[model samples]
Target: MKKTKVKVKRLKKGSNIAVISPSNGLASVFPHIYEMGLKNLSEVFGFNMVEYPTSRMLSKDLYTNPKLRAEDIQRAFQDESIDGIICTIGGYESVRILEYLDMDIIMNHPKFIMGFSDATTFLSYFNKWGLVTFYGPSVMAGLAQMKNMDQSYEKHLKDMLLKNNKSYVYKPYKQYTNGYKDWSDPELVGQCEAFYDNENGFEFYLDDEPSEGELWGGCIEVLEFIKGTKYWPEPDFWYNKVLFFETSEEKPSPMAVGYMLRNYGIQGILNSIKGLLIARPKDYTEEEKEDLKKIVMDIMTLEFNVKDIPVVFNMDFGHTDPKLILPLGCVVRIKPKENCIELVESPYTNKNK
Candidate 1:
């Protein structure tokens, strides 16, 4: 997979942002949140939200229709009016759509596509084709909130979508939610997740003087699961990149985390990257945090034999509420001395729509 210098266009006010379900049809299971998300996308974000054939057509086993999902995505991209694409929600098997996608159509017509969780399947796919994708929020869980969207989360999202053509720097705030309320509960229509304070900032490792590169990687479990699949980038593709990965609500044990890193170590990926931006795992207990950190440090030292890799862990994103919108393949700087992470290049271009 030879790579090219691929840049994508950004979103603008009133631009059509197509919403599609790339994985599980969570909307059928939770219609209220889906509707709320549509309303929010229109009234709050001020975008002409459009849905394709399978955006909200939910089912238990019906999500296996990868062709439908893939076609919806292709159609969304082919639609000239659409300026951005947001996945409806993440599911268990977004990888199924890989074989069905029209890669030429997608690569030729790039837009600001953003997702996470199972959508890592597609995020990594587009990125491999040299198009920058986003690893961030989805429709139901992020755009549609119970009471209201988090102020910080919406601001960053808008910053990226509305073409803030400058180096973007995200600040550390002592507020975030680890999980969420049940979206299926009809009684909790106006409720959101509770916030927790005392959440630590991004912790540095091995004296992170400064490291910079384009963002790579996605949900750790998904990355590990998709390993050896065609979607996983080659070893050369991992070189000189800032690997961004986070765990999900599944809460794989520290042992599992160790094994995953060991696999990366064996693949020479651990040594290939300039730095790691590890997101705070979902539902991680305080004790488990220290335990996981020890596991990572040990693996990097004893097994991988690559110590002193610059790392900034415990940052907000992944399944966590009020997450940051991170653009894959955008040049970013991790400055440990200033305790700051900033984007150096504008991720957006003033191209066609």
Candidate 2:
């Protein structure tokens, strides 16, 4: 299949960004975070946040209803005033609304759409329609970051959303943090830092020295949730793709991760990819992390048997703090020897021109 060039438009100051609840209705339950996120957009990012019908609706029960969530997404995409869309929070039911989305409407207005975790389903849809979407910080996750947005995270996000750049380098942060605190607690809000070390960086075991291709994939659990549905692309569609995957907060067992990878191997999906990027597994215990990594390596080596494939472990992108913003369906180049990952194509067109 011929690849399409993605045009990333620049986001100017004071642009309107729509905050929609496409997954879980966290906005309804934790209105404070939603408000803080919006405030950050206006005060910090210099962008106004537009809240739709479901933005503030906090009923966990209502979130399970896919049609309602789909309506929120459709309305946001159809609105001409909104410059881009950002998800509120990620939840399991996001895949349920896959069929309800009007891809035609989304395709016509290809603006900045950002999310991760369950949002992978939407990203896959956009990829199928030849559109570029972001697999990074969400409103609640990044904008409403516990204290303030991580400097490393904020930088990459701005680069992707505001500055149309072909490629950017990612460096590990000195610290990492997560969870929420009272807004009134100034110390708590401002002092939260992530767990980071100087040793953090990209390490690739590659059969091929250097490789480049369009980047794809997201929360592995979310991808599996939408598998066999209309949202999933044909198996062969992932051929020669640079697949980037990360685990979620739930931290499923190592066996679970291995099973999923084994399935992909069985389907011949592993052999067709140009490379693979796995984020640091967010398991609770140190032992679990080791086990999960072991499981992943074993599956990739034994099941896939594509030992030469470039694979990077412990790269930040998943349910971790100080995350890097990834452009879904955008071309990225990976050099294993140099341990460098570079974006080689623009995901949007010129917005400033």
Each model's Cα RMSD: 1.7, 2.5
Clashes of each: 0, 14
lDDT of 1 at 68: 84
Per-residue alpha-carbon lDDT of model 1 for 228-248, expressed as tens digits? Answer: 988778778987788887888
Global local distance difference test of model 2: 0.75
lDDT of 2 by residue, 1-353 (tens): 54464554566688888888777777776666667777777776789888877777766755667788888887777787887888887877677787788877877767778888889988777887778888887777767773465566677666767776666766555565543445455455433344546365676764658888778899998889877777677865887788888888888787888888787888788888888898877644668767876787788887667887788877878787767878888878888777788888777785554
| Whole-model lDDT values for every prediction | 0.79, 0.75
lDDT measured at residue 285 in model 1 versus the true structure, 0 to 100: 82
lDDT value, candidate 1, whole model: 0.79
Once fitted onto the true fold, the runs of candidate 2 whose alpha carbons sit more than 4 angstroms away are 1-8, 146-150, 178-194, 351-353
Using lDDT as the measure, which candidate wins? Answer: 1
TM-score of each: 0.95, 0.91
